[model samples]
Target: MPHRSSTLNRRLVRYAFATLFAALSTQAAWAASFDCGQAKQPDERAICASRQLSEMDVEMAVRYDTLTGLVAMGTRGDMQDEQRAWLHERAACRGDRRCLRASYTKRIDTLKREYDQLKSRGPF
Candidate 1:
């Protein structure tokens, strides 16, 4: 009957929309700061769990790498020590989403500021 066809069309539209939304959400959830395949710690796993945190991780990693290469050999040791301390602080977040978010935000901000200052000094 005509009524049956209408009902089926509506159901198909609903199904399609639901499927599209689900796919988008899943992709966003894993926006991923690092390669999930290489995640080796609870904090790393936590960072991978949320797109925002993952973004923060990616930015931090990039800045850290850039600064390390730009710094002098002697100060590179100090930078390594500072980065290790930050890692310990991040690890203390322990899968707590709020804590991890805060940690990432703070670290990202700190790295950006430090990087800006170093760049302004025109290399040591």
Candidate 2:
């Protein structure tokens, strides 16, 4: 009876780990699918676009935090211009949330164009 119980316990542990691994793998796949440029299906494209918007929101928030930090550090003149440009780019990339929610492809394209323009303008 003890031997049978031990075997069952081991099996249960194995099953638990397997379940956890599967869940993690699925999450990773979902994240990978959320890259707007990598979607192959229409549904996937929409999902990717939504994910991109969410990511842009997070990025903008981070840029705002950085701007605040720079201000705290007494950034001035050209430094201020650079930081302001960075903030502008972040805001542009964020685009219109309503439009993004209504149409993912257009919003993604807008973001990509804004990002490219920012990159061409040099670093902040």
Candidate 3:
């Protein structure tokens, strides 16, 4: 009975790990925030085509969303406005991978700095 229970537990653990791996593999394989199939703009198409750009877009989006949630309403509004402006800047890059990479790097840096500032302000 103990042997059977242990074997069952091991199987459960393996199944859990396999599930997690599949989900992560799928995400990593296509990490863009937007649907690659529906990608219309040249910039969007470039992001979907390149693994690195897709990952960066996902990272930047996560950071922006998280930071916006944490900040005050006024700050959140400003962030949203800035984000709209930044999208235009990104769109301007079009199919230029180097430009897109630089744009994502800059935006990610800005978000990280803001996050650090917010973290420094509290025990929460």
Q: Pick the candidate with the highest TM-score.
A: 3
The lDDT leader among the candidates is 3
Model 3 per-residue lDDT tens digits across residues 47-93: 99898999899999999998999889999999999999999999999
User: Which tens-of-lDDT digit does each residue in 27-120 have in candidate 2?
Assistant: 3433532354665644444444455554544454454444444433544354456545654543443445554444434434544554565557
lDDT of each: 0.82, 0.51, 0.93
Model 3 whole-model lDDT (C-alpha atoms): 0.93
Which pairs of residues collide in model 2? none
Worst 10-residue lDDT window, candidate 1: 26-35
For residues 8-121, write the lDDT of model 1, one tens digit per residue. Answer: 999999999999789667765455646787888888888887777887887888888888898788888988998899989988888888998888788778778878988898
Error of 1 at 35 (Å): 3.9
- Please, what is the TM-score per model? 0.67, 0.25, 0.83
Provide the lDDT at 58 for model 1. Answer: 73
Q: What's the CA error at residue 94 for candidate 1, in Å?
A: 0.6
Candidate 2's error at 12, in angstroms? 0.4
Model 2 TM-score (2 dp): 0.25
